[model samples]
Target: MKLLPMFALLIAGFIPLTSAYVDELSNERVFFNKMLEVLPGNWQGKYADGTYENPTSDWQPIEVNYQITSGDTAIIENYVDGNESAIMTTVYHLDNNDIRATHFCGAQNHPRMAGRVFDRSSNTLSLNFVDVSNLQTPADYHSRGIDLKIIDHDNVHVTFSGLENGEDSTRVFALTRSQK
Candidate 1:
């Protein structure tokens, strides 16, 4: 029948679109799995503002513990700030074929970010601000971005960017995976 051919054509046209979507999902799964492989551990480092090239005396101790929980569906990062005795947390998980994160900051706001760029060859994942929750004011401080790089199995460099006091601020931490 004529309708049979028409329906076949319609289905055929949608096949490519579905395949492309599936390919994207597969890539995201691969990226997230790679992240799980490299990110679960206790990391110790020093933190500094802007550039971490300041004198050792000026740098503060930074300790981070990453755990895979919720049936391995989420990665949680507990960030300890030695200078302020503050502990912040961020949770990373996949949301419908996209990697997303929610950072709980000391500013009393949570900023949600999504993975904007993933360079598999370099082992880098960059997340940019999407929105914020519990923001009392438009100018209230909240995290803006995150840049995470795995230098090696035991070394990592992370930078967090935000707006504070109406100025762009950054915290850089150079971390080494703790052996003990």
Candidate 2:
């Protein structure tokens, strides 16, 4: 009779711990899956700013198509200035509890860009990248940075900031989701 009571108490204590362990595992899977969903697709928008020499006249639309190859890999193809195209590849992974993306552009010439993801939600996602190395122009020593925020499944807001002549300037980009 005494053993029965002790066994009951032990089982009661073990139940809560097991439940918590299962819950933690489930949460991790949910977060990982959500991260994958917001990362792949096509995004389009326009860039605007008054800092350029021909700001008003140079207002141009931009479109980006992204394909997430895996949990840690993606490719982005961008179109700007009506007909100019640029291709960039990014490899993303979790580091120090934060998601980081290493981007490469001009695959043969100006490749090697690095960035991190700071925020993500159900309907919104944001990415920030700062140029670390530029093989395109060594004398220029310029860095390009971008912040992209998704407002919905089809609309996004982007901010482009970069160093020019050792000074920083910013431009805003508004985009809509294009049909795949």
User: Best candidate, TM-score-wise?
Assistant: 1
Name the candidate that leads on lDDT.
1
Query: What are the per-model C-alpha RMSD values against the true structure?
Result: 4.9, 9.0
Question: What does the lDDT come to for candidate 1?
Answer: 0.82
lDDT of 2 by residue, 108-168 (tens): 3232333333343532233454446544554443325545454555666655555545667
Q: After superposition on all CA atoms, how large is the RMSD of candidate 1?
A: 4.9
Clashes of each: 0, 1
Candidate 1 lDDT over residue span 1-180, tens digit each: 999999999999999999977766676667778768988988898888885564333678788889999877799988876563438898989886788899998888999998777666767778899999998887888899988777788888877889866878888888999886
Q: By TM-score, how accurate is candidate 2?
A: 0.53
At residue 12, give the lDDT of candidate 1: 100
Evaluate model 1: give its TM-score: 0.77
